[model samples]
Target chain A: MRLLSFILGRAAVALLTILVIVTAAFFLTRLAPGGPFDAEVDLDPLVRANLERTYGLDQPIGIQYRRYLGALAAGDLGPSTTYPDRGVSELIADGLPVSLRIGLAALAIATAAGMAAGIFAARNRNRPVDALVMGVASLGVALPAFVVAPFLTLLFGIYLSWLPVAGWGDGSLRHWVLPVVSLALPQVAAIARLTRGAMLETLSADFVRTARAKGLPERRVISAHVLPAAVLPVVSYLGPAIAGVLTGSVIVEQIFALPGLGRFFVQGAINRDYGLVLGIVILYASALILLNLLVDLAYGWLDPRTRTGR
Target chain B: MLLEVSGLRVAYPARGGEVAVVRGVDLAVAPGECLGIVGESGSGKSQTMLAILGLAGPGARVSGSAIFAGEELVGMPQSRLQGLRGDRIGLVFQDSITGLTPHMRIGDQLAEVLVVHRGASPGAARAEALQMLEVLQIPEPAYRLGQYPHELSGGMRQRVMIAMALLCRPALLIADEPTTALDTTVQAAILRSFAKLKAHAGTALVLISHDLGVVAGLADRVAVMYAGRIVESAPAEQLFATPRHPYTKGLLASMPRLDGPPGGPLPAIEGQPPDPAAVADTGCAFAPRCGIARPACMADLPQPAAVGPAHRVACHAVEPA
Candidate 1:
């Protein structure tokens, strides 16, 4: 019962957060120095005014916001200024699946590989293996996706010819290798460091000593007693880390020529496509808020002390 | 003897060299006997037990011979020690709050000892855990089974700890300052539980504590330690009646008494215990703080000399019986 209320409370806060973000994005987009039609150099003023009137841009900001919110309430994201024939929702439908495929795959790989590496390093602490894992994690954090993407392409694509240089070919496993790895690398590095530090601290806790004194095998001690507490920091970190991976896929999508939401987000922002931009921002904000709620719920499950308000 | 430890020394690496914590200690506990080791913090009373159990943290250089049930423990393989630790020898620590895994339910933590050591099925282990909790007289034992460590009070948690340790019916149970972190009332309750445990289990016990009054009630034999060495050891009644070493005498005098004048200043030991790092090689470590110290007390380390039946004192001022 307490868990249900806790979840409800977090979900309510999440909705409020998304609403604030959408409101801020709506005004901030208008506050920027240009409009969607500003790039047309040879367009007549009369045509520009007609275009603005057709898209409701000619109306006062308050009326436009009310109209947008009303359309949003009815599940209409309006027509995209850049893609004249396509609605913002339709564009999102085309891009979201591709983005989700990459994002989910990268998240899985990062969480699993990062935790494994972190545990390995912690187990072999102060040894050569620990130094080596930490050194590579440092490099992963230091290098950006753009730099690492091309470098991987040079080594794995050009030099060895083991994989394709670019493009999503039928969205197969081979197609996912480069984009997913590049997106996941930095998050993996961050998680590894977090898990390693947490694991080290948890290993030295008094309960761990109690577990040892209980005559538990070392493996059982670590797996049952240490891992649960150690993974808490990693779980909390996953909320932001996932958001980062999703947004960071922008450059990877562009470089790999994939039809992901990140590509639409960047193109939408560049062309001042307000409908497309607002739609994508709302989606990202809602997803982030929902993910944070899930993380909180996960915390309640892992640590019972947080189950109630006491 | 259920457990015998001699020449037990535990040292840790420091900047210049190693600093010895438990220096050439000797202790023994017979089957079903309760031996109380009393000393202030850093007196090496706890370290001696930890080193014997191989629970001292990494990089500790433990050199000694500890025989438990005729098996050598000082250099026992970790795998063998793992087998003996909870199955044959149980351990309870001071801080009950941190001594239990915060995330684990009380029943699960208790059940785990039996499951790991005895290969008991989960259902059976849990049933046994509930029984153990009932044995410890935990209020609402069934309700406590589902609760986390943080949900329980400090004394309740300590009781859970004791229950968890005794779940396997180990031959010896070593409780290290089990009641130190509790209130006076709670401490009394825990002591009462320990007394009940002794009467019921017939398990040998090594109770380590800093408070003399704590050990006064339960311990059959009491060993007073100072500056990493045993200064005096005797039957509990005899030691309380006539404490030979000046350090032991000072420790007795410092304890708060109920019959004394209210708010009157308690007699405190004059000087601080010697720092483990700076303890000189050739001298009694407590000589500087000893009121009856002789010149010889500062010249050579005094070995334990028999003063009475099963009583030993390591002071230059005490004559051998």
Candidate 2:
């Protein structure tokens, strides 16, 4: 009953937040000055007005919002004015999986490599090994995806004759490497720094002292007692880190010519495709809320203090 | 002796140079005997104990010999020391709040010591943990096994710590200020269990605390510490009755007396304890704060000299018996 209540409460809040996000996104995109057909030269004014009427852009802002919400209630995302042949829902369906694939890959790389480096630095603290790990993390954080992308592409794609430079592969591991690394490097550095700080604090806690006094080996003590407490901050940071990675992937996707949500969202914003832009915002917002919820649930499992109604 | 520590020292680095917190201290615990180590905070009573087990934090430099069952413990490898810890020599820390992992179930924490050291199957280890909790007289022992550390009260948590240490039936148990934070009633109950365990298991104990009253209830012999050194040591009764060292006298006088005036101001020691880094290398560490300090007291470091049978005091003020 307690768990159910907690879940219900979180779900209600998530719904309210997503509703607000959709409302604000709707108004902002509509208020922007431009039409989807403005980019096309030699278009007749009558044809443009006819296209705007078809996509409901000719209606008042309030009426369009009500219509959009009504359609959303019926599980419809409306049609893209720029991509007249494709509905917003269809565009999302096609684009989401690609973005999710790259985003998840980057997340995995960040978590594994960052956590390992953090743990290593904490264990060998104040040593040469500690300096080396922190140095690499600093470099990773300092270099953005745009700056690192070209260099990585130059080194691997052109110079070394390894890995593809541009365009998405047909799910090939080699093609996925550079983009995933570029997308994840900054986040990996951030996670590593957070983990290292948390790990240092956890290692010095009295419980960790007791764990050592219990005669458990150092490895068992770290894995069993220290890691859980240390990983908590890292888990909390993951929600925002994931959001930044996905949104940041817009530039990454454009540079690599990848068929992901980033590409569509950017193009939609440039063309002033209100439906497409609002639809992508809603998707990203929903993903962020769900990921944070998952992180909270994981926190409850990792720490008993946060367990609902315990 | 079940365990004997000779010239044990613990030092750590400071901004200027290395300073010894525990300077060449010596101690011994006989089989099934409870040896209480009494001192003020920063007197290195805890550090001395930690050094014996090789559990001192990084940058701490330990020397001298801790002979346990005829084996030197001071220079032992961590792998060897780990084998002895929780198996042959158990340790219980002061603060029950952080002694056990907050995220772990009580039974798992108890059983882990057995599983790791004795190679007991999980089933056997768990059964033994339950039995040990019952032995410690933890109410609803079976129910508590499933609960996390935070769910239990402070006294209950301390009992769990003791139970974990005693589960393996170790030859020696080092409890550093085990009952310091507990109320008198809870302290009594914990002491009763400690005495009972020692009687049944023949487990020698090193009970480190600043509370003389708590130590009086459980210790066979009491060692009084002052500024990282043992100032005096004797049978508990004798030490209380005829405390020779001035520091020991001060500690006893500071304790609230039941037979005295009902409402009198409790006495406190004057001057602050010296920081480890500020300790002088030439003379007694407590000489600065000593009430009966003479020119002789400052000339050289006082060594533990015999005062009576099995009684020794490190003070220039105490003449040879």
Candidate 3:
């Protein structure tokens, strides 16, 4: 019953947070230097006025916000100013699947590879293997996705011609290789460091000593006792790490020319496509809040001490 | 003898060289016997047992012979020792809070021993765990089985730890300062449980504590350790009545007595324990602190010499019998 209430409380806070983000995005985008139609050079003043009136941009800020909120409540994101013919929701439908496929895949790979490396390094601490894993993890963290993307393209695409340089072609596994890897690299590095530090600390914990004294095999001692405690810090880290990956995909999507939400987000922002931009912002904010809630729930499941209301 | 340790030494690597913590020590425990080892902190009483059990930390250099049930344990491979520990031998630590895994339920942790050693089914393990808790006189055994370590009180957790250790019915049980972290009432209760365990199971016990009163209650034989060596060893009654070593006598005098004057400062042993790294190679480590330190006490280390039947002491001032 307590856990249920805790989850409900978090969800309510999440909704409030998303609402604040949406309100901020709505006002901030309007406050930027130019109107969405300002780029339409040579257009007659009367035509521009007609265009603003049609999109409800000519209305006062209060009326426009109320109208947008009404439409948002009804699940209508309005027509995209940049695309003219496409609805913001329609554009999202086209792009969100591609973004989710790459994002989820990258997160999965990062979590698996990073935790494995971290556990290995912690177990073989102060040895050559430990040094080697940490050295590579350092390199992974140092090189950003933008830098690693182009470098990987140069190595695998230009020199060896082993994989496709860009684009989400045929929605196939091969198309996922470059972008997913570039996205996962820094995340893997961050998680590896987090896991390694937590694992090392947990390895020396008194309970771990008790586990060892129980005559448990080294394997059981690590997996059953140490891993559950050690993974806690890493689990807490994942919420922000996921947000970073999702937002940071903007650069990756632009470079690779993928039809993902990140590309739409960037293009929408550049053209001041208010509806499209607002829709994507709200989506990302809501997703992040939900993900953080899930992380908290996972933490409680793993550690009973956190279950009781504090 | 169920277990015999001779010249048991444990040293750790230091800047210049290795520093010995448990200098060459010898002791034994027979079937159904209780051997109490008493000392101040850092006297290496705990390290001696840890080394004997092969639970000493990494970088520790442990040497000498520890034979348990006709098998040598000093250099036994870890895989073999794993089988012996928690099966033929049990161990309990001081801090009940940290000694148990906080996340694990009491039943699962208790059942884990049976699962690991006996290869019993989970159902069977759970049943046995419940029985052990009831045997230990824990209230609401069924309810406790579902509770995590944090939910239990300190004494309850210590009881759980003891239950886990004894689940496999080991021939020997070693409890190191088991009641130091508990209140006096709780401490008495835990001591009573240990006495009960010894009587019922016929398990040889090695109880390590700094409190002489605690050991005096349960130990059949007592060994007083000072500066990593057994300074005195005798039958419990004899050792309490006529503690030969000055250090042992000092330790006895320091204990608070119920019949003493109502409001007075309790007697205490003065001076800090000698640093393991700086201990002199020759001379008794306690010689500098001894009230009767002689020139000869500083010149050479005194070996434990027999004074009475089953009694030995290692102080130059004591005349050998």
Candidate 4:
């Protein structure tokens, strides 16, 4: 019963958080010192009233909220007022694939790099190897994405001439390399530190000593006993790490010219496209909620101790 | 001879110079004979055994001779130690359940020692592993093969550990506090398995433990160490009956007895042994801890004086017992 209550509480928190963000996003975009439809020129008075009536913007705030909430209840996101003949739902559908592809590719890169570095650092302990890896990780974390994005674009995209500097190609595997690497750098460093710290603690545990005395090979002991146990903390941190990546990707998107949701959102902000801005904010928050849920599920699978104890 | 060490010295890096933990200790064991090394923590019993197998961690300073079946153990490379471990030199660790692999299937885990050292095929390893389980008398060996380490009881895991060790017919077996984690009944059974392993394979045994009762049951000869130096050596019965060294006498007296003395609890050893930093001097290491410490005892290191034909004690105060 307690476990059920705990899970329900988490779900309720997520729901309430999403509701508040969505509501605030709806009103804040309107109040952002600009108008959404100020694209070409000033509208005539009669035409502006017709536009207001068409989109139901002429209604009072409370009535408008009730109408929007009713549509939201039916899982309907209305047409984007900033873009003609484009539904908010359609805009989300179009952008989600790009965001997810980038997120997943970056997540994979981070996991591999972080786990390897962690295991290596742990195996080496306080040796020069550990010192070198941690030093590099520190540099990675300290450098902001704004600096890293430009640096990557200049180095790999210009001097090295390995990847395209400013464009994403035909949704192929190759196009993902630069964007994924840029987005994953800080997460990789963070995870490496997490893995190393957790593994160092586990390696000194009584169980590890017993395993060594049982005469397991150095490789097998590290992989089977230490690695699985160590990776758990990294799993728990996936939520915030992915959020950091998603938020970081927006800046990378601006630099790299990836036609992802981040690029769309940036353009919306510049043009004051209220509908587009609100839609993107909702998408971002929902993605965060979904990613965190997956991470929580993974924790239960990784360690049965938590599940049973709960 | 199955296992032998002559004047073995194991050192660790210290300030300016290396600190020798086991300084020139000599031991030899024949087939089917059990030898025990008794000492407090950090007395170098574990280190001495690790040095013999080349299992000491990095930067460890080791010297002297370790000859096992005419093969030199001292200065042996890491690759040689990898091959010898779980194969030529079987190890049964204390804390039985923890000693076994937690993530692995019990049978597959047992077979890993064979596969790693002997290059046994999976099927062959499994068969031999089950046979070993039978040897250790684990119940339902067939079904238990599919179960993991946590699935089994503590006694069963210890049995599996023994089975893994004995599978290769190792010439020498080392049990570092093998039964310390088990209950009284389980401990007896584990000790019985030790005898069976020794008998079946003609394997020599080196039991490193603090438990005198366990030592008395398992060891043919006992070497008593205090402050990283062996202070006395004797047959098990002789050591128990006539413990000549002052430290050895205190250790025996400290053991809880079924027959009690009225008016007071058992006497305690007054103080811990002296610091290891102060140990490698020209005098006895146990002299400060020895109740019968004389001026001569503190002035010069006492050589091993023969008490019985096979027994020796390193103290000037001790006469033939």
Best of the candidates, DockQ: 1
Preferred candidate (TM-score higher): 1 or 4 = 1
Q: Across residues A111-227, which tens digit of lDDT does each residue of candidate 4 receive?
A: 899878987887798899999999999888898788888898889878998888777778776677788888999889988998899999877655566455555677876877777
Q: Which digits, one per residue and each the tens of the lDDT, describe model 3 over residues B1-321?
A: 999999999999999889999999999999999999999999999999999889998889999999999999998999999999899999999875778887888899888889999999999999999999999889999999999999989999989989988999999999999999999999999999999989988989999999998999999999999888999999999999999999999999888889878888877777889988888769988988889999999999999999999999999999999
Q: Write down the C-alpha DockQ for each prediction.
A: 0.85, 0.79, 0.79, 0.37
A226-310, model 1: which lDDT tens digit per residue?
A: 9999999999998999788877888899888899898899999988999999999999888788777788788878988787654
Worst lDDT run of 10 residues, candidate 1 chain B, spans: B94-103
lDDT tens string, model 4, B1-321? Answer: 878888888888889887778888888888789999998888888889987876676688888999888889898876676677777788877764456545557777777777777788989999998988887889999888987767778888877777877888887889888888888999999899888767776788999998889999878999997766788999999999988888899999998887767567888888886666667668888777777888998789898889887889898997855
Pick by TM-score: 1 or 2, better one: 2
lDDT of 2 by residue, B22-134 (tens): 98888899999999999989999999999889999888899999999999999899999988988899999886577789888998888889999989998999999999888
Clashes (backbone N, CA, C under 3 Å), per candidate, total 0, 0, 0, 0
lDDT string for model 2 (A1-310, tens) is 8877888999999999999999988888867887687875868889878887888878998998999999998989999977889999999998888789889999999999999999989988999988988998999999889998889999999999888988876867786788888999999998888889999999989988888888999889999999988999999899989887977788888888888899999999999998899899989988989898889888889999778555
Q: Comparing candidate 2 with candidate 4, which one achieves the higher TM-score?
A: 2
TM-score of each: 0.97, 0.98, 0.98, 0.88
Clashing pairs in 1: none
Chain A TM-score compared with the true chain A, each model in order? 0.96, 0.97, 0.97, 0.91
True contacts kept of each: 0.86, 0.66, 0.66, 0.24
